[model samples]
Target: MKNNLDLTQFDFKKDLPDWQVDLITKTLSRNFVFKDFEAAFAFMTLCAAYAEKIDHHPDWSNSWNQVKVQLRTHSKNDITPLDIELAKAMDAFANQIQKPAEI
Candidate 1:
């Protein structure tokens, strides 16, 4: 087993605290609503950059005015610090894009 992690800077408690139990990757799911596909895609583009910058990617899908994102660290096979960092990063990027908190 890995060392216990600190959750100070991450919002895991609010959305995924229990995710720590399962050693198989954890998914942080959020649903974003927009006025149209254009707006939805725009938010996704920004998220893409944020994910790349942090070296953590997400599993996402878009439909009409809604976008769904699920974050997980595949290689670790568990919820590690990287997933926490990505959650924080996504929160910031979503806020910057005027997306309301849903996670």
Candidate 2:
């Protein structure tokens, strides 16, 4: 499977919250909710920059306050380490933006 990871062995629950592996599409997907559209867009921008740096882009869409991201190595026809790495980066980025203001 070249760059592919055995899905059964990967611990997605521990790796990222609300992330799921879709067997049918061979992709790891997650949805992130933010306070508003600006926050959502900012998150997407951060992901975009990272994706460009790694040359591995995500299949994603942004609504007003939500961003849905799917990661897969299309060329490899499966989920690869890149998907996991990106998912982790995304989780970190989301956490930074969605944190509650400490009073």
Candidate 3:
């Protein structure tokens, strides 16, 4: 049996269903879209600070209203607990930014 620890084909469907694991790339990735560029930038800024604090940066890109992210532990050349932590934090940050404004 494959080691469940290996994220090459790891399943995040239960908690992070929006994230997809690519065997070829051996990374977990997700694309986040926001209503506008400002919102997207805000989301990235939040995530960047957290990633920096944890010292586990992610491979990501931002284009106007969207940000695409891929998480992997470069040192190990595989996904690890750090990636999971970053992914979870990113999800929360994005969710907070994407929330609709109150009336």
Candidate 4:
């Protein structure tokens, strides 16, 4: 199994697509907008399954048509490679499901 990666070892702006890294909170966050609540919930479901598989859950919430995700290693108290991997997975998942009009 891979361990947590130091924040200094990664480049957030270059590696992550739409994610924003918060220096203070040590979190990577992104907001995904969908066509409706159903789509948003569906996305969350997919994310939940993936998170469970990886054992790296995200702090996330869903609104009417939007899902907000925050990723960090609670044990490490900083952003890690797991957070980056999860963010990438989320972006890929969102891209796959999101409608063309929404993009």
Candidate 5:
């Protein structure tokens, strides 16, 4: 286990689902796509506000129409419940703001 794991708010093996644990426990990563840069940035802004509200920050990058995010507690060098919660929040925000592409 990484020394940075947030034992105060999570268990290394139990706070997240098995798949999420496997995917992001130590090296948290998720990708989100949107209709365009506008939508992608919108989602990022919303997520930024949420992160600020929670006093947690995520490592992220955005391109024209996609955003890649990684969440973890740097102090612990591992995923914590805060990471899980923020991931879910970002997912929900994306779902809420996602628009279908025009053909």
Candidate 6:
């Protein structure tokens, strides 16, 4: 995997405690579970708006009350700083809608 982001400064284990980064796939992933479908959709809607603003979208899907997310910088063909930033934003959004997402 290759990217321009400075990975050294990021302590992935602590920084994204709830996320999983797969080097084999070069993607950052997480599954977020909400109280209901509406809550799930609400989370997605918030993420969509933020993603649009940043011009970077996530590969995600919703099923009832769960949102499965995978983020990566496609152009770079690897997980980069953009993925990290987006994941952080997503976690924050999840917290705003409710208590927190279930891992």
Candidate 6 per-residue C-alpha lDDT over 15-48 given as tens digits, one digit per residue, 9 for 90 to 100: 8999988887888999999999999998999999
Question: What's each prediction's clash count?
Answer: 0, 0, 0, 0, 1, 0
Q: Per-residue lDDT for 1-103 in model 3, tens only?
A: 3323655355589767899977677789999999999999999999999998989998999999999999988887777888888899999998999899889
TM-score of each: 0.67, 0.89, 0.87, 0.87, 0.73, 0.88
In angstroms, how far off is 73's CA in candidate 6? 0.8
lDDT of 2 at 21: 84
Clashing pairs in 6: none
lDDT, candidate 4, 1-103, per-residue tens: 1564666767778888588888899989999999899888888888899999999999988889999999988988988777888898888888778857555
For candidate 5, write residues 17-96 as lDDT tens digits: 33244434575577788889999989999999999999999889999999988777788666666777787788788878
Would you list the clashing residue pairs of candidate 1?
none
Looking at model 4, the pairs that clash are none
Alpha carbon lDDT at 61, candidate 6: 91
Alpha-carbon local distance difference test for all models: 0.66, 0.88, 0.86, 0.85, 0.75, 0.88
Error of 1 at 25 (Å): 5.9
Order the candidate numbers by lDDT, best to worst.
Answer: 6, 2, 3, 4, 5, 1
Tell me the deviation in Å of residue 36 in model 1.
1.9
Candidate 5 regions off by >4 Å? 1-25, 99-103
Where model 1 places Cα greater than 4 Å from the true spot, the runs are: 1-11, 14-25, 99-103
* lDDT (10s digit) by residue, model 1, range 1-103: 1344543444556765433333333455677777788778877888788788878888789999888777666785556666766666666665666765479
On lDDT, the stronger of 4 and 5 is 4
Write down the TM-score for model 6.
0.88
Model 6 regions more than 4 Å off: 1-3, 100-103
